[model samples]
Target: MEPLPAAVTAILLDIEGTTTPITFVKDILFPYIQDNVEEYLQKHWHEEECQDDVRQLKLQAEKDSGQKGFVPIPSNTEAELQVIKGVAANVLWQMSLDRKTTALKQLQGHMWRSAYASGKVKGEVYDDVVPALKKWKGAGMKLYIFSSGSVEAQKLLFGYSIEGDLLELFHGHFDTTVGSKVESDSYRRIADKIGCSTENILFLTDIIKEAEAAREAGVHVAIAVRPGNAALTDEEKSEYHLITSFDQLPLQSTH
Candidate 1:
């Protein structure tokens, strides 16, 4: 848990199960989408943005038609009630399978935007996250986020967090649009986007696959060990640096 060497000039973080509690996503955010999606659709169905959301979801559903247990959204020609029901059912089905398709995330992002702005939901973060962010930023290191969630969804969490707006803490955010988290090329792409070499980055994530991917990209890594995250095996515990709090991960000292 010593200060990371000066060679690592940037830190890339994961959101759920890393900087934020897994329960926040599992018990709150996901449920918020489930409980309110139908009402949201009913309220906004006439709007162009909602229509775009529905179009994207229908496209996704078409591709998923052959998948087992897939739920299909009816065409607009169907009865309005039937189409609404089909869209809601499709959303629930994708969510139940924990799918991370961009279509699903786009709708969820838009919905969470409404929920967060209305004060119906607030983002959660560990108490130690902000202080450590400050320490690192003060030390002249860049910060960024890389999560499976969409960039808009990532912003909503930090922008409306319980700790208050933390959007300023990051230089940029990356989602699966860059590439899958388990692929080494995504880390390379992220490093390129941040204008740094992969060797200059340190990635923090709870998943070993992501840690391995980052390492393969020549980025340093520290696996975050947080509550509600899957337990790392004994060998993994010894193989990767494990951190329970951001406080344990000091960067190059400013002084």
Candidate 2:
């Protein structure tokens, strides 16, 4: 492994296919939502928080529909039922397409909280992640997470991980609420939020497009290749540092 770049003082990590197995998300978390969303919504629909979620999803759905008139969600049982079914369908559709809209992510996070608390789901991280995180923290390197998952969901995951609570390792979390990961401006915003120069933050992920976006934002970038991650093209391999394990990442001693 090469020496840690001299300028890097902070590390930004992506969750899926980077620290956690993609299967945990695609097979477990997502399927749990698909199987349980309607029931969960039905059980909680009258509550203020659930109602708020429904309202937000309806607004997003209406915006996406591009229709002229208002799509009213009435208070009556029959009307509420109709609206809830429509919102559930839309949420399922969005999940199927893997859309990263804030409302959807928020609602998914809400649902996942219950699943995680009930011990129905637990987060998975690569074997190398814990040791690497400890080493980096010990060496005075700040660590953060940037993922499409809502900050709440991110907390739920690390807070309930198979490795035991690992949320303490992260300095902060960023989600779609900050900006799209594919946009360079998002990386710039993240750097600002972390109070670091963009060039001083090393961003790691399995996605080439995201790596390119961070690079364009003037941040250091690396591509992580893990089991179950999408195969990288030769072009990507040639353009960025490819890391198969967090252990392979070089860290300079701060002591």
Model 2: colliding residue pairs: none
Model 2 stretches with alpha carbons more than 4 Å out: 64-87
* TM-score list, all predictions: 0.92, 0.87
Any idea what lDDT model 1 has?
A: 0.91
Worst 10 residues of 1 by lDDT: 246-255
> What lDDT tens digits, residue by residue, belong to model 1 across residues 1-255?
467777888889998888999999889999999998888998999999999999999999989999999898999899987898899999999999999887998899899999999989999999999999988899887899999887888899999989889999899999988999999999999988999899999999999999999999899999999988999999999998899988887677544
Candidate 2: Cα lDDT at 70:
27
C-alpha displacement of 163 in model 1, angstroms? Answer: 1.1
lDDT of 2 by residue, 154-235 (tens): 8999999999999889999999878999999999999999998998899999998899999999999988999888888888
How many clashing pairs in candidate 1?
Answer: 0
